[model samples]
Target: MAELFARDTLSSQRWRRRLVPNQSFTLGRSTQKYPVVWDKQISSQHAQLNWNGVQLEIRKIEEAANPIFFGSRPRISFMLDPGQHFVIGHTEFLLENSEPTMPLPHRSPRTEVTIRPEEIRRTSFRKTPGRIELLTELVSKMTASTDHDQLITIALQQLLHGIPHATDVQLLEQSLDGDTKTFSPIAWDSRDGVSTPGGSSQSLIENATTSHMCVLHVWPNEPDPATADFTQIAGHDWAMCIPLEIKLNQVAALYISGKRARLEGNLTEVEILQDDIKFAELVGSTFANLSRNMALERRQSQLNQFFTPGLLDHVSTDIESYLAPREAGLMVLFCDLRGFSAATEDNIDRLIPHLHQTSETLSIITSAILAQQGVIGDFHGDAVMGFWGWPVSASENPLGGIQAAWEIVQTLAGTEFLCSDTPAKAGIGIAAGQAVAGMIGSRDQVKVTAFGPPVNLASRIEGMTKPLGIPLLLDDHAVTQLQSHPSMPPNTFLRLGSFRLSGLRQETQIFTVNSGEIAWLPEFSQALILFEEGDWPQAISILQSLPTQFGPRNLLLQYMQGFQNQCPASWSGTIERNTK
Candidate 1:
């Protein structure tokens, strides 16, 4: 029978489907047909495979998002001869001529026990000089491999090489979820060219896993054909399964089988010696530790997107201590590109370049936050939200957010990121207060973010930057915190004035920093004080006296003129904003 054998290169999973002569089959992610789940790279209708009486013909269909790779080059259509294979996404599909057979059950192990490292005496294990050299070479290969799949493949190959009589060696991942247990093939190598060697004894594997030990089973020579357990060890005489401890939920095992006839000697049922078993156990232990380290490194790489090296090191030691949700003091910062929308709209023909430009701009903001040891919360299009003091108290560096904001302004000023173009501008807002901060979301998805009035106030202050004619603003709390902190630089913090933020009841005093070109700061401060005190005449006089280049003074002059040169009766020294 003709069949299509599929293997997931990363997961070490195998799936096969019998191909009928002159019949068409679809291979992709569509539920109505042959569905390839979990891989998004494959389109719903990725390709079509047709197996005629002579050979198999595979063609890349139009719906495939990614190309079908034949070796390194992509092929739109190709004839798959016997033993030919092609790759789509992470799955490799091959055409085979052999008829698939069900795996035969294996006999129970006569002796299974957890092997103690100290119990394995050196006197009991003996190896030739050539065998020792082979083991050394295999160990070097395993140590150099960083990927789990590659490591498993190397371990299997090395095990097969070390045990010359072994017919096949397989690496299997055994996982327990709730009451169900699963055994999946990770990698396998055979003395022959077979990709997946069959006739593995389940009873032996189960015994090794249950006891977390090494199981050795030797079938009797010339055994009775009527016994049901006889067929379990049909092809091989003796087999050994060494359990590799990876984790509490997931355990792996190394299964090695050998046919006594391959030894070319008059041997009994037990040809697998203590030396061979000991070597397999050693390789299994090395694979287990390396696999665990690889998984941790991959997870740490993902976490690096949100945390700094220092914070991530702490997080790695005790995740529950930092990730648990709780109320704590922190500083939150909100940063946004000033004219992103207009810039994107104006360059609609070159939107991709503009998007790349936006990403580059956002990278600057992210780098500044991480440099200050702040955690990135979320990104909203052109805006980025970051916070400090969760997992760790912000009492040590309450001015981190402030410092980051200042750094962003200073960094953006030197580049074309904020050129003469209106859309190239940026705005930032910072606030410090107590809030519930930690991982927030469902079981499927979660994010570390702060939720409280201070968070809202920070966003409101960011919005106020445009209307107030300033590039950056901070709430009064941030200013107070910065005042107490001795780490502040020589930059001037100008008081913008008090205003009622949208959706916030209490008025928040706004302040902006003189990071650049704020000429006539004293005049602007004088005008703001007079305007807040309802001294319209003197305030207008001082505001007019200041340079028109001062945005705050110009904005104030416009506000006073709108009231016909008189303070309104309802005015309470606070500007009321209707929107954020």
Candidate 2:
């Protein structure tokens, strides 16, 4: 008898039929005469297979146009040998000759073959490039590959190549909540060398939780009286489910199946089961480690968004110690876009893109600050805060804050923001003093920030820029600190006189940077001095005579004019701010 195993073209299913000697059989779409009937693609009289006393031959009929492939290559027709395989129109057939044997008058049943656990281990370990070698290779590959999909595919291919009888393999991952599950098709190699999706007979998670191996025999057409209650849901004739322990209290399953169930040597079905389970465990462990490393990388990426690169490295080493509260002398910078609120209101439809561009502009400012070894603070609405000289001292370069602020102003002025109709501009404020920096709030909701008079004062100074009509401003402390540094820019700081802010009792001497192209520093300095000395009339005359475009805006000139009109005997040069 010649056994013809026909695999379905569409579903990758296999069926068995026996061919008798000197009998002819037709294979086509007509179900009446042909034992194998595929769909419309197969012609009514597609091909004929004839079994002579010794050999089987296949011939294409008159209606068939497509040629059949013998073995792995295409051919018109060929005689089938004991193990010859051929494919016709997506369906493949394997020929195996089983010689008839006469039975004795009273024959005893054949005994089942079984092997000891140690014997199974010896057979598996005897293979070339043994289990240990295979696992080491798998570990190296998993460690080198960062992509999850690629790693899974490589592991599956290697497993199939190692096991000759395992036809299909799939990986089942348990969902985090343990309520749902998903499976990834790793690799499938059938007799035709075609890949097929693996099927399951039971819930993979349920089987995996048992933490054991199980083998089942599937009968497609007949119900087995021995195991009548359990339906064989797998596509293949036999399947083995092996649970892989990935971690403590966590398990994943590897499903292996094949169309034939035959043992070679001491490699019985149970021994093959043991070998597959061991291999699955190794692959699962490698996957577990890779998953942990990938998770750490993701967390580090999120932290990079909040901290500078230098701070991030230190934080990763010891996060709790780095976040501890401490008092330190530092320079703080506050910056806000000039017309951000108005821009957002004007282009409501494009708000998201507008905000993305705003974020990019802020990123540039952040990079400038980080270049000077500064740490980014909180971002509130359109404003961003940055600081230096804490977590580590930067007192050796006290001018770092001012230089960073200057660069931020220059960069924002030079770069064009995307999706904006008008040019974007920013106002920055700098202050250097003692501050308390640390992580605040409860464990569930905490953030790192700096607090004290300097932090509050920096915010106030940034607000003064709008009224001053300048792009950058700083308190007297920042100016004094920069002046003490030897590398301070010549004539960059200009005295803007004293002002009593709304919250503070004492007056703060505010200053502005000489960033504009026009040279009004000399005239502005002289006018500031005269105004301080109670020479309001002369100061107002000098301020009025200066070019409007090159001089201060109407705010300062109006104040001087008001002072000139009503001069009190006890009057001082101090300006008071009633509102923030």
The top-ranked prediction according to TM-score is 1
Instruction: Assess each prediction's global lDDT (C-alpha) against the native.
Output: 0.74, 0.64
Q: In candidate 2, which residue ranges exceed 4 Å CA deviation?
A: 1-285, 306-316, 414-424, 438-442, 489-491, 515-520, 550-553, 560-564, 567-572
Most lDDT-accurate candidate = 1
Give each prediction's root-mean-square deviation over alpha carbons: 8.3, 17.2
Residues 461-576, model 2: lDDT tens digits: 88877666666778988888787777776766777778887798878898877654456567777887787787877777777766554324346677766665455677677887
Predict model 2's lDDT versus the native: 0.64
- Worst window of 10 by summed lDDT in candidate 1: 415-424
lDDT of 1 at 348: 95
Candidate 1 per-residue C-alpha lDDT over 1-580 given as tens digits, one digit per residue, 9 for 90 to 100? 6667666777644545556799898888764335566477789888888898778888889867799988678999988888888988888888877631222465454444345544542435444546667668776876776556556666776777778778778777775568877566555667653554665777777777887767777766556667645334446677888877663236777888777634434533343356677777777777787777777777677678888987876765567566878998878999998788888899999999999989998999999999998989888889999999886778645777877887887766432221123332678888889988888888788877778877888889989777765667888888888876676655557788888888888999998775555456677788888899899899999888876545667678887888998999887888878888
